[model samples]
Target: MNLSEQHRDRTDIPNADWESHMRRLRPILDLLKEKDRTLGEWYLKGETAQEALQHRAYDGKAPAKTAIEALSKEYGRKNKDDPKTVGIWNGIRSDQIGASLSLEIDGGEIFPKSLEISLNEKNERRGSRLGDYRSVAEVLSEVVRTYDSFYVTYGPFFYYTNKVFDDRPGVSWMLYLPHVLTSSEVPEARALIPVTRDGKQQGTIIVSVTDEVFDVNNRTHVKAANDIEIRLADQDLLPRYIDL
Candidate 1:
């Protein structure tokens, strides 16, 4: 999650350096590549999935730097003001992996600087590839480290479960708050994973009730996530989440 300040600095005025924006985006692509080989490849954009796969900026397995530079130049030329979105995936039509990176410019929308990376829920192989909670946490933590995120959370796809989250806005397998909250502050400190940088604890990462990939269909997993949300709400920590 890139902060608004970062976006403001990057997308402000005639001096908006799209090349710098692309440079900053390099780490995210790199991180995705490290997680799964199929991630961070094809540049997808179109009205439909099949059409999106056909949209390409460069050919072959070019280095990220080269691809990003080319994409930056394209965005600089064509999509100056529109909200730009690009999906990422391996080029293979069969057994394809899906992920996306999107940026909302300074339009009338709230959270204009939002950068969303989500799995393609419709993909059958998603469960085998990115269905684990720990794997998801590692990916999210890297992003939190990369940019100034107000807060971050990850949960199973809603349809994967029968549980309903009516009390609060949502529940998740993990929650990232950009502040230090200890065991004393949050009795379940065992779940809190510290996000540190430069030898200092930058924020707190709260995992789900268990260490396993959260199976939303499992009553235990759903209950666990619900319980954590209630506990955090009771502690008034739920309101502390930055709404962005």
Candidate 2:
């Protein structure tokens, strides 16, 4: 899972800095390794341990287009774009943005090896894309189910209320990747940096870590849980993710 191209920034993150950053992050990583004990909101089990929390989108009725749009926008709003935005339950959601993202894990798996997200022909707005994708988006949806794994990043939203920072239409830290990134493609980049998410989206990385990714203040925040001021593309390391 090479996530290099998922970032919008393209600056060179110094090796020395990365090493030092990891040293500071290692302890947290150790804490994260014990993922089972950590509880999500309401003492609900975390991603590794769940109590039958399934994300039933559209009730198999609404078109994927209407479904995903409603899901992203309203969810983005309710939490003020806080990356840890997710609510768990069954039945249907009533929020204008959409259903609450109920992130759950089967056994110890949170991230899917292969993803099957897509927009329908009737969907007026475009969803995620893979420009280099030889097949159409519609076809990819079917193929993804058979894939072993997929490279990906999060979408855009304001961090910390009013002051919104978006990285759409460009490969920001949270680029929408459809292919597996490789060390050969970006030799300088590291793989699986493991960013953390708060609340339900915890233990996840939202952006691509590159030399150029930075915040509005032009500095790097090694601690992901609190780096709300930083957005990956600020430093100039935009990505052009590819699919094989």
**What do the candidate models score in CA lDDT, each in turn?**
0.55, 0.27
Model 1 spans > 4 angstroms off: 1-17, 48-51, 54-96, 108-112, 120-134, 159-169, 188-190, 240-244
What TM-score would you give candidate 2 relative to the actual structure? 0.23
Q: Write the per-residue lDDT of candidate 2 for residues 70-162, one digit (tens) a residue.
A: 345544444422232123222222222111123211111222222212111121123222221221221222222222123343222222222
What TM-score do all the candidates reach, one by one?
0.69, 0.23
Per TM-score, the best of the predicted structures is 1
Candidate 2 lDDT (Cα, 0 to 1): 0.27
Residue 112 alpha-carbon offset, candidate 1, angstroms:
4.8
